[model samples]
Target: MSDFRDVVILLPGITGSVLANAAGKEVWAPSAGAAWRAITSFGSSITGLELAGDDADDGVSAPRLVADVTLVPGLVKIDGYSRIENYLVEHLGLERGANYFPFPYDWRRDNRVSARRLESQAMAWLKTWRERSGNAEARLVLIGHSMGGLVARYFIECLGGWQATRALLTLGTPHRGSLNAVGFLENGMKKGIGPFGLDLSPLLRSLTSVYQLLPIYPCIGTGAGELQRIAAAAEAGLLTHVDAARAHAARAFHQEIQDAQARNARDEAYARNGPTLVPVVGIEQPTVQSVQVKDGRIELLNSHDGSDFGGDGTVPRVSGTPIEMGDAKREVYAAEMHGALQNADGTLANLRGVLTRDRIDFRKFQRAEDAAMLTLDVDDVVLPGDPVAVRVRASEGNPRISVTLTLVATGEAFDEPLARDPEPGWQQGIFDLEPGIWRVTAHAEGATPVSDLVVVAAP
Candidate 1:
């Protein structure tokens, strides 16, 4: 018999439990005090009837549903709690329990502890489920939201052997930490230190402080501290410091990116790259930038349908997808976000497709061939009149590719084009440009084309 029996585990994001309760859903909201209380009050019920039923195929079987695991910040009342909680409870059939684990609020405060706790909880649950079902081959699926996704990933990486996990799905999790988080942390810290006299509990302070400073950006090590250092240097009129900090963080971020890419390559390197774990899918909202002449005035217009980005308003499309240690695949639904994942309409339908079908839609990665692919490696300082060698690769197709490299110090584009062999391999060209942020564009002869941005240091 196939060891792949369907089983799903739901994990909620930050403040998800409180939101669930305010929504009047059956969620296990455990505060520190409440956990102690539960241990004392329900000591007997702790080992109560093991919730199990017949196999899914059995006519009398009740579909196995377990308690929802919500991440830290317990539960808080927020607007829209009723409608949102009711919808989730009705759809997912969440249960209340007493064994949920809690972690420090600040992700950076102590990642090691947080990661360990999450792994322990997940492993414990898996063990129990496996023992009860007596199925060594049962397929396990994890559904996580926001940071819950990250926790789930850490759990899989730490405790989930290749043979243990079947699939993982994340909604609105910041695999690559979001820039918005930096702002949130900074503001929270300032408030905690100033008005709160830093008297806030360690959990609250950490939630509002420490994790913000570490390099948490998915695959990139550009943490809030690094960004703050850059900002401070820039404010202090230390252009050099700003450049160095930016470069340092970029390199760190690039390392993680490269690592992720390498992992992806390895997964695709062979036919059976381990037990058939498929790609992790994410929903992304559509975004477009446009400028229009309104009443003879050039106006920049940025408009998004409420669901235009894949994230659920908080997480981006890139971060919400599950982290496959192998090949990475993503799907962007034009109008989807965190909450939209369970939509009954086409949104949830797409999710179901990803869950059932092993293939991913590739159109999300498609780019107009006319766009130029630019790659830069600045091993030395970027100074004015520095001899910079830039390499570019452009697709040989209609709307032929044209390249432009600009010096930020002077609003001047190099008078010459970077040598383009239009060959299959790397092509190199030299430019004497001043230090600052450089802009490179690959244009299709007469059409507006795509571009990439790079900052070069002043030598």
Candidate 2:
């Protein structure tokens, strides 16, 4: 067993910098790689993992735990400057200049080479860290953001064995890949631009073709070629094997990636199969149309698509929680962009809880001035005099909350008010009224007011 202390490696997403900077003795900014390079031309005494070198035999071993925090293309970046990063740091007690893992390239390109390169680099780093730390039994905890989550899974399934690594905590990872890739590829073709405006390497094109042929988890590929495939699939209709292959390929890819990681690792320190998959879900506030189930698929209903079945303007709920490996845990939070997972306190708490497996009450760390509305549903219908209950949830400070129920019967109005609770979730209230149309308004004593409309039938 290595004597080295437990290490929490932070892996940054595409175009992401290390967690913090060098100021205030708190390292945030640029990202781990950039930070590492900037601090000194020479490497730090702190154990480091690099994706490009012949540093094997340096005593590195498998089963190394990882924590990925990389950015996804077409999604918001979570950096120290971003509100999401601030929220996560506060909630997770993360230091500004700590050692965290980061991805080597962009995941938006959907290139298997990039994925493979990242996996190889992470594996080497973990092996070396384990050997150097003298803790062969040490576990790896991977926290991936957006597509970085998928990359982490691929790594574990491809290399992690039971003897190495522990768990995987994915924040807004698209295991099945994202439909947005289709759009990106299409737009690129129209502009005569290559993948991200760079030429598509022949190997990359081959990988893309192979991805499409796979029975599961097919690669969306990068650039114009991928766009053509998407169009072909649509033209072939949803019934053809081509379409089936595309769908199955994506699923299979996730399964296979996981299966590969499970097959290669040592079985003692880590689980025999793939690392445990934990999905973090995001929701937007004041939007009753945030979630939807269409064509048997659960999606995040957002304003961008007007279909009540998209995502927080970028990631679809189906893509957000795509992996189906092992017993899984889910956490939901309020935020619009996928990167918001980093800043949403509730989301960060849940992530920390998963990594540490310790019980943490998020309510204790609540901030003052945080407020959200609570809507009640009674038998799938909104009706007056039907025991309508509403509550106010605040982050901090005592806010006088009131609920006013107006009954429009015989041109008469009756108002009833309720108290606000400073906790998360819902509170109940009872109301009985004469038959008529009723409008209910819930206003916090010192905050904004929210109202709902309900109708009651005459007996």
Candidate 3:
């Protein structure tokens, strides 16, 4: 444990931290059984064991305790950023409590609130370390995933976290924002296999964190043309009051980023004195760019081609990879999914390199794209009658690459000139197929062909 050099804090993203009630009951945590109950119990106001801050009327209050959650007995571990914790403890030789800690907060609250709490907790930890270890020179490093990254940034930039922080590293974080939040706001949340799949829409309506994640750029729209402003629809009575609050929060966060960018531009000293900002984002994954809500129906505009506008199933690359300020370094990984970014070998190597100030051999890790890396972006599963969009990209910067999508089950191929959306390398159309396992294969000229198994579930 003493081999650890500096204190490190691991901040989890939305639903990444486990929370318990006053009575020690698991309130919010991962469980296959809990997820099954939530789905089956259709009409209950609250389903499953996720009762985080149930007494709080606003749903943005703090949790009673950041409790430890047990891993499922038999199932293999997958998804979330928890594995990163194990890697740091076991492989990196970091000791829990002594040199490492997990900063778990109520994710539904405003990022500013989380940032404040993080600042307070980190300061306490640093003080204790200085007193006990006699290492007054000891500084702290912050590693945040997804929403946790945003919270850490707020603490460093706004809450004076730079005073004690050595560096700030973010993984798959939406520096700008994510369009998926719009989907949640437009259509109530859909339960997925992971925490993102749990239908938390009813409680999410009052969540400031969700609203803060709305894309800073104009992308989502309604029947009255593209939403010109955040509160445009809500103010016009087209959206509910809950959505109006979300729009208000989204606009506020956008302004905050703009202000931060402007401030950092003028006062060069601000960046010079602050902690080093390192942002590592995932690319080449089909990420939703926009959510069009019309007549109470939602349409997800996903970036199928691995464009800069694309995302890693959650955060768009453009939003995740913001222009760095100060001496901040940015790293991009192709084919790394958002949920698994923290555990990916390439990402972990880059992080270790950054910490040790050593040069990383990129060749050691697998590249999602080769010399002419073919990047394919699409959902892993879709509902019957749902329009499946496919986006393909070549490292040579060719947008018009010859690509073919074949359904293995039915032996159907879509290789002709498909209809394009407003974006490049994007095509969408409905394929009539029975519910079963479907292998979607894409081949690009002069590039390695890639295949992804997609499930076509019954509607």
Best by TM-score: 3
Residue range 43-85, candidate 2, lDDT tens digits:
2211132112222222222221122343322222443324444
lDDT of candidates 1 onward, in order:
0.40, 0.44, 0.66
TM-score of each: 0.41, 0.45, 0.65
Candidate 1, residue 149: the lDDT equals: 58
Give the winner by lDDT: 1 or 3. 3
Off by over 4 Å in 2: 1-5, 12-99, 106-111, 131-134, 161-163, 187-252, 258-274, 285-310, 323-334, 358-459
| Residue-pair clash count for candidate 1 | 22
What stretches of model 1 exceed 4 Å from their correct place?
Answer: 1-6, 18-112, 158-162, 189-205, 208-312, 321-329, 332-334, 337-347, 350-459
Output the better candidate (1/3) by TM-score: 3
RMSD of each: 20.4, 16.4, 22.1
How many clashing pairs per prediction, in order? Answer: 22, 62, 5
TM-score of model number 3:
0.65
Model 3 clash pairs are: 191-197, 192-197, 304-391, 305-391, 370-373
lDDT of 3 by residue, 108-187 (tens): 66778778888888999888877777888777899988888888887876666776888888888887778777666666
Better of 2 and 3 by lDDT: 3
- Give the per-residue Cα lDDT of candidate 3 at 224: 61
The deviation in Å at residue 345 for candidate 2 is 2.7
